[model samples]
Target: MKGLSWLSRLAGGLVRLEGRKFTSLKRCQDDHFLTPSKGESALYIHIPFCRQPCLYCSFHRYQFHEDIARRYFRNLRTEIDLYLDRGFRFAHIYLGGGTPTVMMDELASLLSHLKSRLGGAVISLETNPSDITSKNIALLKELGVGRLSVGVQSFNDRLLKAMGRTSHTGVEAQEKVRLAQGNFETLNIDILYNLPDQPPEVFRNDIAMVRELEVDQVTFYPLMPPLNRGDPLPPSLKPDNRCEGLFYKMILEEMYDGGYQPSTAWCFSRGRMMIDEYIVDYGDYIAVGCGAVGFFGGGLYANTFSLDRYSHMLEKGGLPVALFRGLSRSEASRYRLLTTLFGMGIRGDGFPRRFGDSPSNGIQSLVGLLQFLGVVECDGEELRVTAGGMMVVSRMMREFFSALNRLREYCLRYGI
Candidate 1:
């Protein structure tokens, strides 16, 4: 119908009316259920403890205490064992968090276990600006960290203060980057944009800062405030999707002119390097630790958000799985299409090779739909995200994460 065609164009061309239902979860006991596959997958470790919880952060986290953190680390190792015992093998490991470097020894121990077992698997880690110490950097290198991503949302003091991140100054953040730049194979900095009052000029300076630091990679995140129902935040801290799109327009021009390449929809790098996005690189990753999520074997799995629940379940010799849903065949195909296109675009044969069906099987008619709208361009051999399509992908991802953040908000609030 003419009306249906008009609606698809409005929804940005990758619309899914309903998603998978993951209401049921099973107790993860032995390795038999987690059969190994021939494909290589990455293992994601979520460090859920933070020195201070940022007000706008949506990921599940708790304030760090030495005693409790040490216990959490021990449990993390136990969780890793659960996967290994279940016949899973990871060629790469990504450590993400509420500041994975908050406790040095625990981080070191976890890496030690991984190195001994996985045998030179690539390791990646995340940290806050405060953790970028010479000692910490040295330790990270010693631990085989190939990629290090630092979350420096803004170099503007005003924005940093507004975000409740006061531990380090903008100057100190640059100094830390100076120290971290050459130590790892890839050094990536994360910057935030589209704040309540962030001007185009301020964002431009942040990009200049990236070049000045000479960091290998950069990831710009449009502000997606977490879902919360407590005292309201200032209007300045809220998200402006319209404003976000404008900033994204600037990113496309600035980064491209600067000679950076797309590592993902948001990540740009000066040279080839490992990106922090497991989703962009690996289709089927296993996420562990409280509040983490994973996709493997045609199903999506979620770990508990509550520390108490996470620890208790793992200690009882279970996988801490809180939710599980098997994606429909079409859903799986569409997912592959979404993620691949988010990066360098998809090879024409990618869908059929991965999903055993043509792109039309999962994407439905959206192929012709998006191409018709100038959102994407297709050569029979490949489909690539065009300059115009960047904003579309940005909004699409923002909406998806917003929904997930809502779930995180509810779980953390009611202790679900």
Candidate 2:
């Protein structure tokens, strides 16, 4: 384990350098790049309106506005129509937010409309602790939401207050977790660790809460605040690597002890769990809401972060893509490999079917290097991250998302 730890850190350093290069922004060389195809891809709808923007959040979200939200819903339906008209089929929907459950009525209407198009599909929605009322929970279940993930950053009142997220007390957070529990196929509690000056015990208590509540799934995220060029970094978000590592180790230990298996590097659950992370599950997806990003047809495309621009573009009957970066064959394959590893393994036997030829044909060096360093091993035709390599994969995935978050910052800032 110690040797794997050292190699993982070394791999993290190398991956960080590659991530920086891979995520560097390029001008939108092609505005008319989207070409709808008859492929299966998940749909991600961004709810840009939030009741309140957390101090540490930089995702595309606005202070909630009722009238604007109503219009946004209408425009969102139109945006979905644009893709459907082109024969693009999506059977999985992941709703991310400002807060998807804030305007429940409109959200339900929107989901109904999406179901009409897809002829019914699984839906996963993200919500805040404050929105976990019996009414909202019931309404979401009625809307056929298979997964409900509540963001409860911490169970410690002091940490919640320190993070400026005391809108709900620690007690309220726990009650909400129980309230939302058992209502969906998978109830996921989103926890944050490596918080600035956060003690290891706080995370231990969080794991305890998960076990006590018997929540279906838990996602523990290491704090990965995007470095903004214009905005000064917040003092409260300075995360320590040692703390993160310790907390993750504790999480793996506790979850496994409790019979929770890892569904992803950061996500653990007792049984089948609905995952909202589209990347880990799908190689390509279409993001429909403002401030969302999509990867399809060998390119990474982002929708406009500006609500007005988004609605206007849909008003004019056009896709809301503001920028795009086309990926080469190598970039695409390596991306697939990374996300596959993040999900715990790469099925080598199916490599020819998914990417043509074999794993050795494109990213051979990467697979070999991982094996060479004991970071991963081949189980017949499947390659999986070793116990020691989870953190290494986590670091790499975190850096990749950090890079995308930087892209999100640009989109949010310039309203692109």
lDDT of each: 0.77, 0.80
TM-score of each: 0.92, 0.94
Candidate 1, residues 348-372, lDDT tens digits: the string is: 6664455564554747476677778
Candidate 2: list runs displaced more than 4 Å.
25-33, 226-233, 273-276, 358-361
Total clashing residue pairs per candidate?
1, 0
Question: lDDT (0-100) at residue 21 of candidate 2?
Answer: 62
Clashes of 2: 0
Q: List the residue pairs that clash in candidate 2.
A: none
What tens-digit string does per-residue lDDT give for candidate 2 at 188-263? 8889888885788877898898899898888988888743546666677777665567777888889999989877
lDDT of 1 at 209: 85
